[model samples]
Target: MDAPVSTSPRPWSPPPDASDVVKSIHAMLHPRNIVVVGATDKPGNYAERIWNNLIKYGYEGGLFPVNAKRESVWGVPCYKDFASLPEPPDHVLVLVPARLAVQVIRDAAASGARSATIVTSGFSELQDEESQRLAAELQQAVRETGLAVTGPNCLGNLSAGEKLFTNIDDRAVTMVQGPVAIAGQSGAIVMAIRQTLEDRGVGIGYMVTTGNEAGLETTDLMNYFVVDPSIRVIVVYLEGVRNTKAFRDACKAARAAGKPVIALKLGASEGGRAAAMAHTGALAGSIETFDAIATREGVIRVQNLDQLIETTECFVHAVTPKGNRLAAVTLSGGKRGLLIDAFDAVGLNFAPPSPGISAELGAMLGPGSIVGNPLDAGFAAVVDPTVYMRAIKLMIDDPDTDIVIIDAELPKAPHELRERNLRRVNDMAGEASKPVIYVSAMSIGFTDYTKELRQTLPHVTVLQGLDRAVTAIKSLIDYAALPKQVPDVASSSKPSARATLEKILKQAEGAALDEVDSKKLLKAYGIPISKEAIAQSAIEAIKIAKSIGFPVVAKVVSPDILHKSDIGGVMLNLTTPAAVGKAFADITARVKKLKGKPKLEGILIAKQVNADLELVIGASLDAEMGPVVLFGSGGLDIELMKDVALAGAPLNEADARALIGRTKAGVKIKGYRGKPALHEASAVKALVGLSNLISDAGQRIASIDINPFLINPKTGVAVDALIVLNNEAARQSFDKSTKGKSTKKGGGH
Candidate 1:
């Protein structure tokens, strides 16, 4: 069938110049010829701090300081302006006031500077009209001159690869150079990540903070890092993303490149969203949507900075295991118990050794040693260090073990003995394809001695804190277990179907659709709905019920009312014409007493079909993700139970089945005790059908509710359907404005 007809503004996109983006990033990362505007001799000023960092960090490139009042800044030549510089520099650091930032950028651009870092505040982040106007001018400058800008309210960036330290961080002078690259929206968070990694003797390859993100967003930097050959892992400190499509694409690219992207996302709570909005001018979109995309794109999300650091460190050294089975070896029984609990908490299974292997281990350790999973080798390993090494090797070689964890007190061992043990394990890891982790049982902090060991033996993953180590491994396994992304099916609404829906929506205008029209719209998409007819009077109702057959159901139809049962507007199991007539009269009388005296259109007569289970399938529009689908248990307590699974729309059969499997009702639907298993493919078909409707309608639809859909052994049929249109109150941009005109009142199911 032909795709839906009409125009829906496409999802947001980034800047359109690829070459310009690369050149800009290159200039930011490798600014050999630099000019610092607003330089001064004031000791505590931003300019002085930046100059000190450049000098102390041994920047081996030419630097020119711009200041009309000073002759020089810390013995470096000071130019009066960009025009006065010896030659046009590649980059400029603007330390001027917010009002003058645009003018400075204009001058820098005129002088052929490809990129500029505006170290000024008071832009759209302030959320005021005047500040927004200033931000607009700054954007104009970049657009008109083809120059790349980092921030108008930001804490600049640092490049370790080129020794180009442009940020106001003085302590960055001593940062070690390594393979991990960090891109963050918050400058302070980036600095903190660098310090935390540096304290552990982990060097950084590149560090960047896209403050305010006026010209280049964090996703832009992520896209750059995914392709950079030197970056093995990418770390992100996220508040929000302006362009969601770019962020998702970047995550996919990173996954395809075999690089792990670790993120610490804030704004999970309402208070956090408020704080995040005040801090940065971002929407702080739904946490649920973020989670769905993160899982789909293979981005590893963490709760806190510590988890972020721990996960990144683990990925740097550990190999992705083929399965979630873990073989843990701890010296202490108490520690072994702790490992079992931790592993179970994170859903990691313990792999039991085979009988032959168990016998060999039992003979090696002698009596009293537990030879099963979570093996406590007793004092045999401590007495003879060679024994522990041999046991570790045996676990690594076991077919059932995909990950090997050894909890040891390395600091207590003799220095030489510790070295020999770690070195052998590291060498063994090189030969074996599986990952081997060394968990510090003592909960010790990193010291010079440990730093030396990490630097010397980089292959063995050494992690501190037992709980943190297990949590990190769980994350690794989760990442490894993600199924390959399924190619999307051709699920768009056909032109004829779209036109039918549009006509129904137009006829109803801003009102809620009655069951007849709702069912009509759904039926166009091939979704099964119960056979029924609308009857305007008691005589007609009785006739319709008889035609539908005995044991029919009747519900009041109204454009002004929702939730017919709440108002006594529904009657079920009509066995005779007398019952149908009386039920219709009773529903009409009951709805008349409702507070607002809702308008009653007619009574619906439907054939009652036999069903083994009830299910709910729905779809709606999300501000960020566009379209979203939901599946869960259906009935009066669907809200109380809240056992629903949600995902972004345009779903294939695989995605639909995954969503269905996450609910308690799904378990019952599979087969409860002696009950026969219902056809799950029926539910999957309904979900995909709903997804297509949402995608085709796009922003024109407000919401959809299909509750208590009956599922029998052969098929699932919609017994009731409710569709709400995108009225003035339901517009996507309704909530952002502080002032608005009054809107018409309407009801939705």
Candidate 2:
């Protein structure tokens, strides 16, 4: 069978010079020489901290501190300016005030420096005219000189591979180079994440804090890290994204390279969004829209700091699970119960052991053993110690298990029995085909002995805290299940259909289309709308109702009245001409009695559909993510219920189905209780058609709301719809196409 054609908009792409930007970032991170501007001996100054950090980390690069008033900084000879330097610096660190930061960047660029990190804090984040102006000038300087600058209000960055530490953060004094790379808009967040990962023995390859993002944004740093061979996993701490296209490209690049990009996105709450705006001068757009984009790009999103650290640990040390099936073993019954609760909260279930494996475990642990998943190995394992090793090995070898987890604790003091047991388990883990994780019942502080044990047993992933461990395991499984390749969106809209839709839109007289006109647009896109027609008079309405069917619905057709039912302008179950005529008269009278006297276009007579389920499908242009589609329960209580799921559109049947499955309405439609399943395929078709309509029209249509799309056992049909036009686009398109023609007041055929 041939695949259905997609009419969704093409995926957003970064600018053509994205590769060039990445190359410049590489040069900046690996600079052979760095100059720190505004260097001084003033106690507790930013320049002093950066100087001390660079020297402390043993930076091999030629570091020259420039301060006109100082002869030397941190016991290193200081240059007066960029031009007085003996050699051209590849990167410059600007620690001067906001007013002088732009000139320093320009000077560095003019002197052959490829990149600069502006540590100055006064920028748009201050929310003042002068600061905003300074930010603009800084941006202009970067553009004119083609210098890849990092920030105007940031704490700077560090490169562990080069032993380059330019940041003012005191917590990250030790340089530990490993497989993880960190990027964030908040310097404090970047440093905190670095500390957490480092404490867990996971070394960071690079950490870049892009505050204000005057020139170099977080996306640029992400793109650079995706290509760095030393970085195996990328962690991002985002308040908001500056460039949507570039961010998507960077995430996709990481996914294509077989690297996991874990993001700790903030700004889900109202206060958090406001704080993000104040902190970085970046708009923290809708979290739903951000989540939709993240899901499509295969980025793993974490909620808190603990989840972020633990999930990163999973990716760094553990192999990807082949399936969702998990096998957990614990010695203590209480710990087993905690593990079960944590797993259940994350929708994870332990795989039931096979009969043979169960029998073997029961026999080895004696009759007291509970031989299911989360198997309690009893006190026998405690007495012999080898029981744990044998049981873990059995679970790993079980065909039903994809991943195995065992609860164990690292000894604080040296004990021969504990060390011997751990060593045997670790050796078994080394030979196991599946990933074997050692989890603690609660969050634990790492001891010197714990660190040594982890270092010695490299094959075992020790996850502390049962809740965090489950969250990490869930993330690992979810990431592995994500599609490696992004799907392509190829347009296959029929020319005639698109032309008809445009004509309907161009003819729309008001900002919002009346029911008759909205249905016309939907019908043009091959969506099944109710059999209906507009009637200018009672006699005409009666005639239209008869044509539709015996039982029909009559609604007041007015561009001004969006909610017809609220105004008592809707009449249902009109089974005769007399009923239809009275309904038409009543609807017109109700509209005339309104305070503003809303213009009544006519009466709409639509076939009354009796269905088992009602669903709402919609599409709107998001500020950051272009067009997004929504699906959920419908009817008048839609706002109250708020059971909606959103996804970036134009959607194929599969995407439509997935969107539907996220809502409770989807489950009901599939068949709730004893009720039989409705026509879900028809609903999928309507959603796809609506998505294509909005995507094709772009900004011409602002939003589309199709509520109470009635679905019977056989099929679904849109009974009511409203299309809100982008007022500016509608006016411009209307004027351009209908020049010198008689303008229509209301959309009536």
For model 1 the TM-score comes to 0.88
Q: Which stretches of model 1 miss by more than 4 angstroms?
A: 1-20, 172-176, 268-285, 409-414, 441-443, 483-492, 505-508, 511-515, 556-603, 731-749
The lDDT, on a scale of 0 to 1, for candidate 2 is 0.79
Q: Could you tell me which 10 consecutive residues in candidate 1 have the lowest summed lDDT?
A: 272-281
Residues 630-729 of candidate 1 have per-residue lDDT tens digits of 7877766666776777777778888888888878878887888988888788788788888888788766765667877899888789988776555553
User: Best candidate, lDDT-wise?
Assistant: 2
As for candidate 2, its clashing pairs are: none
- lDDT of every predicted structure (CA atoms): 0.74, 0.79
Off by over 4 Å in 2: 1-18, 268-285, 504-511, 593-597, 671-674, 727-749
